[model samples]
Target: MNEREVLSNYVYQIVASLVASGVEQVVVSPGSRSTPLAYAFASTKELTLHRQVDERAAGFYALGLAKATAKPVVLLCTSGTAGANYYPAIVEAKYARVPLIVLTADRPHELREVGAPQTINQVRLYGENVKWSAEFPIPDEAPQTLPYIERHTVRAVTIATTAPFGPVHLNIPFREPLVIDFKTQLQRVSFVKSFTNDLTPSKQTLAEFTSIIEQTKNGIIIVGELPLGTDTKALWNFVRELKWPVMIESLSNLRTEVPEDCQVFAITTYDALMKNERFKRNVRPQTVIRFGAQPISKFLMQFIAQSNPLHYIVIDEDPMFRDSTHSSTHFIHALPGEWLSEIEISHVETELAYIEFWKTADLLAADAIAKYGQTANDEGAYVQLMLESLHEGTDIFVSSSMPIRDIDTFLPVLNNDIQVFANRGTNGIDGVTSTALGFSNGRANRKTYLLIGDLAFLHDANAFVASRYQDCDLTVIVLNNDGGGIFSYLPQAKVEAHYEELFGTPTALAFEQVATMYDMEYVKVTSKEQFLATITSEKQQSLKLIEVFTNREENVKEHRALWTRINEVIEQWLDML
Candidate 1:
């Protein structure tokens, strides 16, 4: 076979293997070295190709697709800094455990150490961020080469979608002749498929856990960030049976559409109440059962430390130690769904005083917060309005930093089925827009909403250039606080000398101009009624942006005063204990 035929078969076999392994969608960024793969992907009818210009946005776009589908989505980019642009998304996919197959085309071995243009050390570039990385052999006619290509492609998909799914890398090197022959169809070879078996706990394990539950009366369950589309029926039944004080994180997808009876035990206001010196000192859990990752609240983390449960159990199917407190006494390596569905539970007879106390404190804190969020014209107030305005079965993607923190504190348990998503893996603010846009492609995307900070919006505007959202009914609500609003709450705010120049680095850009540049309908919400009306109104455009301007200083003061008020209310309640 000639060079053209060799490259054609290699690329075609790789694409077929990806399909065989269950990659339904692939996002591609045009580049010279990746032309062969792009053509192969575009030519195949089994795969869907999304052409994007910016590699950074393209990377995050793939991440969002993987998240929405709960399957492995392939990402293809050229060598050099283009692949490096994918680093942030790769890191997020690592922590978030989204399965992404990154295929980066690189220069051949001859170009290395010669400082070739558009070339860098492409081998294992993502480092520890990926679960596994493989460097493909150059296109050749060696008998073993084709088999290796076929098996490795399937293997990459298996590793990516296996237990604790995450990103995987495949660096393909191509020489000057990057084009493929169009005369003959590329060879599509067959490969083996991969499957992941569910891990269920044994009867002895279940009995032991039951004993732990029966012995302890004041146990608590902490549900953190769960995977998207996790069937929570089993989890809900477990929570219902336990009737423990469950702290539901914003991304857990547990609080949305929860039963009113279950919501009584859900202490969503713990972030506000945990800050109280007396509450933290007095309230304690004798046993703690944690599921998923750690919650995004530092105050809650501190409270967990203060609570200091003696019989703590963390559950996961992988080797990861999900307990950040390092105080957990047991780790169960079983899938949450599998064990939660199979476990047998019989409630132990005890007084309902422990959970009753939490129910009262939670009500007081929630009342105080609702009053503050009523008409304060603060960011939290805007967020509260936005959360309430979302329709049932809608998807809301929140950005990190202040946006997520606000959602965590201000959002109350709702009966509507509103799914919440965030990039809290690394908690970076870089690709909030692209991830949301990517998520907006699958089911129920026509009513997708994004609650983002102003800086995150400006930083990721490149995602709009080549994005072709299928339904495109995306409503972006930007909290335009000018600069980093979260920084004002930290101790660094006291360093007023360089705070404005350094931390308070405001970008005074008229977002209306940005809306004009992107051809999106722009509306600046001024009053509380106007903001609520704008978000709840009919959707006429493909993409509409609503910017609510706020003050950095005032937001800090507003958040503190609300917390103080909550503390006062909770303190009064805790005095009886």
Candidate 2:
């Protein structure tokens, strides 16, 4: 093979190997330093190449893809600070436990900071944010670095997809010999799965967990955000025997027929239980049996920290906590499904007062929501609309801040088959759209629904420019309340003049204009009924931009009104007691 052919083949070999190893999505940023890597990925018909111009956006785009697919998505970029641009997303992925495989091409070590353009320290530049970082040093003149390149690529891909997966960086230093022809390159291929093996709980651990469950009849199960394809059946099997109140979070894909005896919305009932004596007695579980990753609400975390149940046991693959409070009585370091599979856990025959009491509270809350939460006046209403409209088994991605909070608070995720994801690790608003679009490329059959705010949508409009979301069943709902809608609900809004100018800098631009610029099908809806009827239709192949018109000022007013009413009810109940 000639130099150009060798280069092209090498790129082909690396991307093909990644595809063979189970990485279906590759997000590439247009850059010269990494032209070989980018070209190889783009030419491959087996792997889906998502082109995002901005390196930072591309990084998060890869993160979103990985989050939705539960597989590592590769990110390719040229040398210099292009790799550095991925740090924010790196931190977000690290905290969210999503896998990101970053492939950055660099100049040979000879160019060592000697006043070279776009040359900064690319080695370990992201610091501690990434789970693993390695460098593949290929000589510019030597043509026999193929074996080393193949080995490192395979190893890097493997580690990135392992359990507790996060971002892994493979900084490749390409010498002149690296820039070879694609057609004449030799292909050394391996079909190894780049994924973590399921770790089952030991017999001893299962018995220990069963003992804890048997000791307390009034136990509560708190399910958090589970990755896609997680075995919810194993968890349901164990929970069924307990006859306990299994509390499902918005993201937890716990869709096996929930036991009739279980309380569906236990996390939201924390405030009422704390204030009402009768309700507390009836609703408080003797033990809290927690499973899955971190729940989204701060209220739930604070409640767990303060309430401190009689026996708290967490079943998960990673022992790390996602919240500020860190106190667990026991943590079973195994997949919840695997742990439950081993234990012959029998259901407790004791009466569940907590489940019965919370059932009534859940009913009351649901009724209230049904009655008063139907308009496009609040963020919660947007969530309710999307949840009611989106297709079953749709992959929903929510941005950080109010978008995720609204979904967590109101979206009634009844199907375990449908996947839901959010950038919750660091909870920043950056790259929400890019990540969602990147994630959609990996799904062959499933459609992706990305619900974002106008500010976030505008911030990552570059994502739309790249045509990555085109032809995918990708629907982006921009809840255009205009300029930082969440700020109106925050304390800053208390000062009207300062709030309107600084915090709530409402942009007057229409949402349709954005869709027009991106050449997407745009639909504007002002009412809940219209949104529900329109979104549920079975349609695929084009990007649909649904712009929901909402007023930030009105949204804040409704939120405060609800909080006031809830607080008043709490005070009245307390006074009566």
Candidate 3:
């Protein structure tokens, strides 16, 4: 067989193996070196190929797809810096435990060190960011090479999707004359059977954990950012069965639609209520069973760090360490869903006052925050109003920093069905729009909206060039605060000398023109009522951008004032105690 035949056969089997391993989506960024890989992936009938011009956006695009579908999505890019562009997404995927298969096409081995054009040391380009990285041997005419390629490709998918799931890199170095026979058929496609094992805690482990739970009524449960489609019902059932008040962060979709009777058990306002120093110091629990990644609230983390619960058990499906407080006394190696559904956690009812104490405090904080939002006009009320009015079953992708924090504070607890997503893994603001766009693309039928800030929206302006969302229903609510609104809440705001130029990096871009350039309908949101009426009136099938102007300093003052009011409510309750 000639070079074209060998290349076609090898690439065909690679794509074929990926398909057999349950990969239905492939995100490809075009380049010359990756011709063979791109052509083969495009040729495959079973795979839905998504093309993105920006490698960075493409990587996160795949990340969002993997996140939404809960499956491994393949990412293909060219050699050199094209592979490097995937670093941010890989970091997020690794830390977030999203499954992604990264494939970077490189020059042949001899051309790597010799500085061939478009060639660099693509081997281990992503380094430890990926779960596995391999330098694939150049395509060969030998019959045995087919089996090696097939098995290696399959193994990559398995490693990425397994527990502690993450991205995997396969660097393919191709010689001159990249494969051109797009119609070349595969000699053989083989698939090996594989099974997964759930890391369930043993009887002794569960008994010991349950013993701690039964020992005290003041036990707490914290469920952080879990992967999409986790068995939230089972986890909620498990928490409620224990009768322990649970703190579910915004990223954890389980916080929605809590029954009226069970609403008291859901602690959704720790960010505001924990602001009261007295409540923070007084409301100490005996045990803290945390599931999934670290909770997003800084106040909550500080509370846990200072309070020092007796037994801090971190229950996670991933074996990786996510104990942000670093005070975990027990580490249960079990998925929250699997353990909650599989194991029988005995009903350990607590003193009526214990649950009522938390219930009252939560109700007070929520009421105070809601009342403040009624009169306040800032990013908080903007986010609060929009989220509250979202159509049920809307998938809203939230950006990092102030947007998520505000949502954390103002997110309505009962009868809410909106699923929130964010790139909180590494928590960098880059690619915020792209990930949301990919998420929109993944669930195209669902009414999707992106809640982003000014800087984050501009940071990924390149995201539009790489996406085909011009026709998609992606309602982007760009909060044009002019700068980093979250920075105003930090102490650096006191550094009047350099805060504006340094921390307050504002992008005063005309988003009306930006929307036009990006093929989106621009709507300037003037009032909360107009905004609510616009979003809820009629749903459009095209991309829409709703721009809301705000002041950075005003947003901070608004949030602090609301927290102050919530603290007042909290302290009044404590005074009665």
Candidate 4:
């Protein structure tokens, strides 16, 4: 076989192995050096190929697919800065434990540091962010080249999907003639290697955990952002058996899935309730057991730091120190499902008074929010209405900054199975729209909703192009305060001279024009009734943009006023306690 034939066969083997390893989605960014692998992936009958023009958006797009599917999604890009664009997504995948297989095309050894057109350091490009990284050799006519490529391809897929799942990078270098002729029929190869890891804790460790649970009288369960594909039912049962007050994060998936009847112990509005200094001081637990990552609520973090419990145990699959407050007394490295399933908890005869106190506090907070939401004309009220209007099983992607914080603070106790997602891994607003679209594409059966701010919407406007081409079932709710609304809550809002220019940074772009340019169905709602009517109408099968305009000053004021009301309600409840 000629050198071109060898390169073609190598690319074919890699793609086939990936398919056999159960990667069904591949996102390819257009480039010359990656032509061979991209064409090979496109030719494969079992693979779904998604084409994207921007590498940064493409990376997050693939991240969303993997997040939704709980499988590895392949990412293909050309050499040079094209590979660098994948860094943000890789970091997210690492922290969020999403599986991704990143394939970047590169120049051969001779082309390195010699002023090649699209050449840079491609080896270990992502640094410590990736789970594994490697540089593949340029395909040659040697007999063993194809087998080596096939084996490594399977290995990369396995690593990406294993425990502590994350992105794995494979820098593939190709020589000249990076295209394959149709006349050369490629041979199919089978890879039969498999990897498995069992991270079940020891019997002694489970006994120790059970002892810890039984000894504590007043304990709290803090649920953070759970890994994708986690058994929410198992989590609910575990919390129910413990009979402890459960503070669930909005993205934890537990908050939306738990039945209202079972939510007596579930504190869904802790973010708002903890803001009351009296409530924070009185609601203290003797023991604290945390699961998953740190929560999105800064108030909860501060509360944990201030109310340091005697036994603060953190249960995580990975051994990383996810505790930012440094208050954890013990870090138990174990899968939450496995640990909860194996450990035997004898019914502890602890007082139900503590749990009842939390339930009362949560109810009072909800009542306060309802009172304010009836007349408040601000972003918090808008988020509450939007969340209540979503149908069961809706996949909602919340953008960072104001949208996520608003939902955490004001969203009501949901009876439906609404799945919430966000790019909280790195918490940047660069690819919010594209990531939501990718998630919508992965979960095509469910209606998807993206709650994003104006600045975040504009930051990822190119994602609308991808959405238009893919025709995802998505409703983009743009909370347009015309600028960075979240900045008003920060200390910089006090700076009168440069607040507008430096922090506010208002952009007067009309999103209706943007919607028209992207051919999306557009609606501008000014009142709460109009907004409710729009979301409750017949769901669209194509992309739609709904804009709700709010004033930054009014939004900030409304939030402060709502919190003040919540404090008053809490004080009343405390008097009864």
> Considering lDDT, which of the candidate structures 1 and 3 is the better prediction for this target?
1
Q: CA lDDT of each candidate?
A: 0.84, 0.70, 0.82, 0.86
At residue 260, candidate 3 shows an lDDT of 68
For residues 1-577, could you state the per-residue lDDT of candidate 2 as single tens digits? 4556656656666776777677777888878788777767766677777777788888887787787678878888888888888888888888777888888888878886897777888888778888788887653225656556666777777776666677888887765644544454337675454455676776787787778777786777788877545767677766656766656766675532343433343334343234344455445556777777767666566666766777777766665644356767787776656556556656564464556656555555444455456443566776776766665667888887778767665654254356667777777888888778777766757878888888888888777765744444578988888789988767787777777678777778676776787777878888877777668765443788988888887877876565555545554554664
> For residues 1-577, could you state the per-residue lDDT of candidate 1 as single tens digits?
8889888888898987888888899999999989989889988888888777889998898888888889899999988999999999999999988999999999999998798999999899999999999999999989899889889999999999887889999999988688887554545666655656776777888889888988887888988987644677778888888888899988898778678778778889988888888766656888888888889988887777767787888877567857677778887776678467566666664349888878888899988987886647789888888887778888889999899999998888887888789998889999889888888874443468899988888889877865453344578899898998989988999887899889888988758877887778889987788898888888667789998998887888888889888888887776766
Clashing pairs in 1: none
TM agreement with the true structure for every prediction: 0.95, 0.88, 0.97, 0.97
lDDT of 3 by residue, 1-577 (tens): 7778878888898888888889999999999999998998888888888889899988888888888888899999988899999999999999889999999998877776775687777778888889998878888987678888888988999999888888999998888698568777654666666788866889898788777777776888888887655777777677667778889897887667676666778888888777778876657888888888888888888888888888888987766768767888888887766566555656574677777778788888878877776888888888888877887888889999888887777786857578888999899899988888778878877888899998998888778775463334588899898888888878898889988889898757758887788677778986788788887766453778889888777878887888778877777778988
Which residue pairs in model 3 clash with each other? none
Q: lDDT by residue for model 4 over 223-330, one digit each (tens)? A: 988877777776777876788889888888877777665778888778888888888777778889898889998888898888989889998878785899999998
Return the TM-score for candidate 4, rounded to 2 decimals. 0.97
Global local distance difference test of model 3: 0.82
Better of 1 and 4 by TM-score: 4
Q: After superposition on all CA atoms, what RMSD does each candidate show versus the true structure?
A: 2.0, 3.5, 1.7, 1.7
Per lDDT, the best of the predicted structures is 4
